[model samples]
Target: MQIVEDDIRVDELCTRREYARWLVRLNSLLERNPKHRIVPTISLSGSLAVAFDDISVDDPDFVYIQALAEAGIIPSKLSSTSLFSVTPEDGSFYFNPDRYLSRKDMINWRAQLEYAILPGTKEQMSRIRADYMDVKDISSDTSPEFFADMLTGEKSIIRKVFGQSRRFQPNKPSTKAQAAVTLTSGRMAEAVQHELLRMEAESSSRQAAAEEIKSELLVRGDIKNFWNEKLLVERNRGVEVQKLYIATLQDLDKEKNLQAQNLTENMKEKAAMDCQRHLILTLREEIEETSERLASERATYVAEQCNIQELRKAALMDQEGILDSKSILEAEVEALRILRTWVEDEAKKSQARAKVLEEVGRRWKWDNQA
Candidate 1:
């Protein structure tokens, strides 16, 4: 169990005083909770190389150092020469255990804590074994798996402390303030991780909601298109109906025109038939009159022919009578001629006789005179 020391300035330099307080608190917690005895043990040197004359078991700083080493946070190989080494020329070597912890040391310690907290699975052990091989200058007696458990796991506590790179400059010391901050950061990593997970869950929910909304919109659009198509079909039907209505009207008009034409033709035919009837009646009457006239003329011609025959007979009778009269007149003329001839003959005879008498009388007178 890691101790969360109250009154410790986690953002300031971690002084020896703060380390002592933290250690004391850790011991108290361990005493109170016997079940938290799972803290890993660290290998410590059997003896210190430099003999510090002033150092004793009751020394708070020395005790705190020992406590950290036991908890595997600090290595037992902490160089004590700097704390207890005497100057070559002077005997005035002051004891100052208030040295601030280093950033590197704190990171190392944090890595240890993280490794201890990891579950000891077979895969974890194998991975740690592999990881430890990559670490330079590993101790000869250190088990790779055990060393891995004291170093780091997948969640590198070192990275959270140092930012970005997890390079452990093991020898590089840390400021007391930086060490305090590193410790506090390790404790806070869990909360931050949980918050990130929560945010991701919210984002996923939002994405799901957006997809649902898009599907709904698509459905609505399809419905709208369906309605529009129906409307278009209805509109086309109306246009077709109008076309049919107009065609019906035009057909009716054509029928009416045809009927009127038929009526006019019938009337013309009736008029023609009436005129023909009148002409036939007139011709019939004329033919009757002509037939009657021909009959009358035939009768007149027959009578005239009879009269002409009678006239011809009368002329023949006249001619015969005239011929008879001429014959009678010629007979009379012949008779007259004969009578004149007789008369002339008688007259000539008488004149001859008288002459003879006159001749004889002259003779007689001559005789008397003689």
Candidate 2:
């Protein structure tokens, strides 16, 4: 008997590791015996390890065994005796391998045996042993094949074998098409539901993406419109400045024509009386006025031009500012869209998780009822 340490905590008695060790040992023993090949598999019931730890006993014990005779591990005839019987003295069952072996001349024939240990104190082991031995003879060969033909059988080992075989084994996945069909039928509803959920999630993601694109387009259009409006205002101001400049040049031209007419008329009236002096004086006055007017008009035009230049520069700055704003807005919109999408995705994931949890709960309930 190899002792394996217990690791998993259940009750105070046994651990998962100890249980695993015993299972391994039992499986190995069953595999060695051809006679016991009728036995399908072995399984342990209840908290065997926990029970063992609670026991203060020092002796060995047999707890329970479920023998599967259909697997050809245990002999069909001897399967009934497979049900465990406890011994009170040592809390162990005694096996007389020689009685079962017909050929006494055979040497070193080992009986393949496997047992589980149950918990009990040293003092309790003796009492349990006595109780077990008093009930029935577990070692008795109840098979009729080796007995007289006229003898009536008192007990059927086959029935006991079947009864003890009512243990659980993990079901293996089916490879055959028929078994696969059966599994598909059983899980069809869940598979359909899962696929539907996946499609719905994909659709929602697409819808969110479309909405984000729309939002970006709207913001870009607004920024573009604002920038264009500012450009239009600056263009209109430039037109006004050009019109004012043209009007000033037309007024200066009219003043020059009026002064030229006045000088020619004065020179004709002073003929032969030294009219040259009068004509020169008139021309000088006219020239002085024209110069003064030209100077004033130039000053006004320069001031207007400076103002227009400043306005143009301001418009340019405004255009740049609008562009900057547009860029910032674009970035912000993109970020908002991304964040919104992420939030929606997270929400969907959470919903999916909840749905899965609900489905698991329903399945668990159905299995329990079954």
Candidate 3:
């Protein structure tokens, strides 16, 4: 069946009247062609199908007609703007023409078709069969009678076939406001899930860093303590040497004085006294050497102590810095953990709300239709 030239150009935007006219024309055409055996089928690939009840002036219904044309169920051609299909040997239908189009456009159209067919119930199916039987015997398939019968039959049959295929679940029937709420809630839950995962990762990283810092600080402290102890031992050794030298000098002076007094009575004793003086001078030299050595040793000990103290101070400062850093990191980790918890809670609430909204929408739709 050929579409009349006048009916060829449907309005770019679909209106209720325009839709009715297109349906009528299409039904007439199908009825005249026995090979086509076209029957109206619900589809959800047009703008009108997506937003059926709330369709704006710009929305168009995306529909498919079931036909035995070429031994397969295929969509009917409506206009140049209507989407076309790609034939696959696997017998699966595809909207290949719309592959390049925006997803929103595709989804809206598909939804519109779904909404249109959802209203048809079982009672409408019986009427469609009766109508088809009335026109089954017409020999001249192109007659006005054939066209009328096809339109009536096809419309009834298409309208009566309700429910979606198991594969294509309809959006929950709800007010636009309710649908919006459900979408927002779902998104919020998804965002929260992502945030929680991020927080968990961050917390783990912070703990690892803190442990590394603490270990480094402990090593530094141990080295500082070792150096400080070494300095103290060296300083004590210097003090002991100084005391021993002083006691030896005092003993040598007493022995020299006693020898001088005894030798004062004779010339030989005088020579002996001179020798004793030389010995006393040698003892003084020894004492001076010992004092100088002790002073040098004491200076070395002080330098060592100074160096050790400086090292200790630096190590302590580093330890303090590490401790501070650890504290800050711990606090940040805690904050993130808290935030993660809050996000998870919010996600749960949002998910629950979305479920409730969807259930309510389904109930309301059923009641309204009833």
Candidate 4:
């Protein structure tokens, strides 16, 4: 961390990087432990505001307080700063007495400033420096030379201080362009702002004239009666309007009821339509079943007709065969007659055998029997 030896002394200049780093560090330290913007003599705790305005700087109480503060006896909050430093979400920075003060007391701030003594006595100036630099009283020989001795002595470490380097090609190239744009934008808005201001001025004047007229009217006692009468008229009109509103609501209710009735009728019609549709569907199904039955019956009838035709054809073929062969038909008839005659002959033989009491019956040789 040590940059130089204790025994050695150099007159070489420090780099800008070192300076910048130290500067940034100092800024960070300040941010971490913020310094007071001002140290006030007055403090407010809740509703209670404690002020040192009653005591003058020459007073024993004021001197005693400063002594105690120097001795670290009095608290910094009570001795120097306010109870609170309100900023951002911290409320107002300046002291505003408007919260507790009345309209009559708002302008009366001279009382608080009655004992407002400017601290630290000023040394009489022998001559004024052209650059407004005050004559610094450097008394101690052992005291560190803050500026003059360090810059002038042969043991001076800083030989030169340089300004910012040429930034022809800057780190942020768009910065210049953006700054130009911002400036141009402001210039562009100037005319509009001027016009707006002129319009606002005219409006303000008109408002002021209206306010003046209103203020003048405040002197008239009759205006109160006029407003009261107007108010009464407005209230009566309001009552009539309310009655009309109620009548409108009643009409709306009636309309709703009518709509409801219509809706009910529509629902009934819809229900009837649905029932009719269902019945139509049922009838369609029945018709389809009947049609299917009829189709089956027709097929059966056609099938039966086909079978009857086949049977009739068979009958006609047999008749045709009989017509074609008439001799064969006569032969079959004669054979059937012979078979009947044989049965009759058997009956006669049985009777004859019965008459003889032991006669044997004769069988025909039709069975190939001998």
Candidate 5:
């Protein structure tokens, strides 16, 4: 990960955002699709070679490597999670989604993660295979009409979710909207918080100590980095929880592609249109639970936005106060300058008076002596 480390300072503490990004990269490597292509790395002159849109030396594996000539960090400053903190007490590794950040001894972290995830992935695949094994049998023995009926039954539930999402998606401030984002956008608390901090720090009072610190942190890209990490952590948590289902979904996709070959043109078009709603996983607990969660999260988001507006208003008031203080300090400085000038004028007059008396005394002594 020293791709960016050559000129970056090692002693620089990782900002929360940087830490959060680190967590995602590390988790993405260990917990994501096993076959997801890792970004390629190239070395030249004992440093990472320049490249465009590829690779990060900040990755956990390479960040602490002693052989690289990049800026580094105190490895212990980071908090620990599953792979970093694993103990083979009973000989099985624990998977706590705790800190997800750091620990000192990281030489074998990848080994620890492999040890933890290997058995879980195998078990999950076995269960998924067992569940899907009957699909071919069910299709082969069924008549055409019976098979069509089965597809219709399952497709209707999917249609309901797809239709509902379509209905609500337009109501959102939808000049532009991403398909995967509509549902996840319901969790808007973090976005609201980001707006609040951004507004407050955009123009902070220089004389106000707290505001100065805020501005400095904002300038250094520290403030937003912290919040971004928190959001990434939440996203990664959801991703980790759903990790096992990824393999199942991959198998399901293959079956779907095979089944699609038999469909007519119109039916295929309809199927393609509904695929956008795949993110709306409203099964198991039913649609109502998803709706309720969305509503609750949306309400929380609105409340936070209101709070941000209030905070910005308060910040404006503080800025006004700082301006008033600036005017008062300026007036006091003018008065001090005037007083100093008057004192200098009086000292010059006293010096002139002393010189006159000295001249008079010297003349009187010369006349008495004559």
Candidate 6:
């Protein structure tokens, strides 16, 4: 089952028909080598069938095949087959398995492989023509140049599987030896990649476990600190509670002593108030008696004043009568004074008559003696 030639150069080129034949040979070589069990991402048989269907049903080919079949230039069996049964499931029947593979076919194979390996929902062949595809080196979308740039990009399936290359000539044909070497190289690269991914996954798991263990240890320390703080709080609370209990007992005893003192003072005050009440009642009664006595004495004094006023009026009338009698006595005294003055004149006349009679007796004695 020797598949690749020792003299197959990397730059050797062939036609699309020739490349298909080589691809079939590569798949056969991979199958016979049981030691390398790498599964191809794309089925070589399916890709060939699709190519055969395209060539058969295309406008020119269909017209040519119809013309040939109707004129009896070609077999009629192809007309009935009509590229209809070339489904993904039954494609191997149309294309000869030993046909040579073209660069276009290689692009299809690599793109399918990328679709299988990479992460995306859109199919790889469709993405090759999508506007977002960065294969700027490609000359035309309809030509084989487009797939050449797609397969030769930095992260392309061919670059990943077969290592980096300066160019991917999609129009160039592929030899059987070249196809075998590319397939073998791709399988080995995938194996090595799988191994590296497994090792990296294990390393990441170990790092995550270490981080988790560190986090648990930190949590344990925090728990210990929380309990220590809780113990201190409980101790302080106990001390405060004991102090509060003692203070409450002292306050209760003080309250009891104050209540007993208040009761004694209340009884003493009640007795004093009762005695004062009795004294006030006695004073009120005495005041009533004194008021009655004063009223009676005032009436008696009023009667005595009336009697004194009558005596004063009688004395004034008697003094007036005595004054009239004294005036009559003074008039009688004046009449007696006039009668005494007349008697004094008669005494003087009697004295003179005596003197005359004494003179006559002296003369008669003289006449008798002669």
The candidate maximizing TM-score is 1
TM-score of each: 0.29, 0.24, 0.24, 0.29, 0.22, 0.29
lDDT of 6 by residue, 58-84 (tens): 533333223323322222333344423
Of candidate 2, the 10-residue stretch with the lowest lDDT total is 102-111
Off by over 4 Å in 1: 1-54, 69-100, 108-134, 137-154, 185-370
Better of 3 and 6 by lDDT: 6
Task: Write one digit per residue (lDDT tens) for candidate 4, span 129-236.
Answer: 211122133212211222221223332211111112221111111222222222122122353356568779999999999988777777775568779999999999
Q: How many clashes show up per model?
A: 7, 27, 13, 0, 8, 12
lDDT of 1 by residue, 239-258 (tens): 99999999999999999999
Residue-level lDDT of model 2, residues 66-164, one tens digit each, is 222222122322233443242234443322211222110010011122111235433343343221112242233322221211111222221111123
Predicted structure 2: lDDT: 0.43
Please say which candidate is ahead in TM-score: 3 or 6: 6
Q: Tell me which residue pairs clash in candidate 5.
A: 1-57, 1-58, 2-57, 3-57, 10-72, 17-225, 78-102, 79-102
- Higher-lDDT candidate among 1 and 6? 1
Looking at model 4, residue 81 earns an lDDT score of 38
Best lDDT among the predictions, by candidate number: 1
Q: After superposition, how far is residue 93 of candidate 6 from its true place, in Å?
A: 99
Alpha-carbon RMSD to native, per candidate: 46.2, 57.2, 57.6, 29.7, 48.5, 38.8
lDDT of 6 at 117: 32
Q: Write the per-residue lDDT of candidate 5 for residues 1-370, one digit (tens) a residue.
A: 1213345444443332343233334333333334321222321235533221122345444432211212111112121223124334444322221222221111112222222233355444334432122344332221222222223332322122233232222112211112112111211224435555766776454347787788999999998999899989989998986885897899899988877775666587777766745545445356888789989999999999999999999999999999999999989989888988888888887788778877888888888899
What are the lDDT scores of the predictions, listed in order? 0.58, 0.43, 0.45, 0.41, 0.42, 0.52
- After superposition, which runs of candidate 6 have C-alpha atoms over 4 Å from their true positions? 1-235, 238-242, 320-370
Task: Count backbone clashes in candidate 4.
Answer: 0
Worst 10 residues of 1 by lDDT: 35-44
Task: Tell me the TM-score of model 1.
Answer: 0.29
